[model samples]
Target: MRVLWKIEMWCRKQAAAAILPLLLVGWLTGESSQALTTFGKSNTQPPKEVAPTAPPARPCSRQAECAGISSSSCVRTHYDSVTRCLCGDNSPPLNGQCEAQSKLLYHVCANSDECNDGLVCGAPNITGNAQPHLRVLTPQDKICLCDTESGYREREYTCSDAEILKTSIFAIIFVTSLRKILFY
Candidate 1:
């Protein structure tokens, strides 16, 4: 009888252990479900994004006040005598903001005329592995550099021109010396 009673107690303990957790879980789940239903449905759409506002304009007497603003300068309004900070074209423009002119890259040419004074449209003067393998994009594409053999042609000066240049130099020197002597 004692052995049977011990077995019965063990069965009750096992049943309590298994059933307690299940009951707790069910109770917790029901409570959560009720809370969710009462809370109503959540918004499915994403929150709208707001644009960042520009910094407020400030009073200024010089360009120093507009130093932080990109492409900004100091100007005095006709209505107001005090100078104010205004965003406009700045020298070379910060980060290329505003309608600023872009500088040309070395050896890269958009047109023959765009090249340096002596450079013309033709094959590039680059040597070794650095030479470009692909064809130029522009029909008259040429690197702006001194490459007399391929692109740039040397200006020819006649003997008469050389003599004229020498004569002009001598004349300038003579006139400068005469002026100095007379003034002294």
Candidate 2:
């Protein structure tokens, strides 16, 4: 029965091979479990989120906008003293369009009478437009006398005659007083 003996030997070899792997795996698992007791923080749960740290930042929409565009001079600005979106080319505010070609004329009254002698205030002399006329926004019979050309200075007056009279009286008094003092 040598054939029967050979079959029995083969079965015994297979059983030993399978049992050896299972024993090795059991040994590894047992070693790992022993490590858990000494793991300390590693074995514990994670820390809490705790108020989410900080508020979410505003996201940028346009890709073409430069990096840090909010702080960049090109887009940076203020609205009535409050920080605002950067509007246009870096120049004095010219209306809302913020055209680099134009400038904001520091004005007082809508008419020339409301501004100072050296200064002027009025709408643009729009002759190139389809409707060619000086913009009529003042109360002086549709007249706007404040605006001037590059080299000439215009006499600035006011809408009220009382103001003009007051200045005239002051000038006359000062001149007459100076003349008397000088002569006497």
For each candidate in turn, give its C-alpha RMSD to the true structure in angstroms: 35.6, 37.5
TM-score of each: 0.23, 0.18
- Candidate 1 lowest-lDDT run of ten: 130-139
Instruction: Give the candidate number with the greatest TM-score.
Output: 1
lDDT of each residue in 23-122, candidate 1, tens digit only: 4455446674554454567767699999866443465544445557554444433344444454432122334243422212223344566543444445
Q: Which pairs clash (backbone N, Cα, C closer than 3 Å) in model 1?
A: none
- Winning model by lDDT: 1
TM-score of 1: 0.23
lDDT of each: 0.44, 0.37
Residue 116: error of model 2 in Å? 12
On residues 1-184, what C-alpha lDDT tens digit does candidate 2 reach at each position?
9999989877876775665445445444666445544545454657877773432222222212222432211221122221222222223332333233211122213355443343455543434451211222122322223334533333222223445567668767765675455334
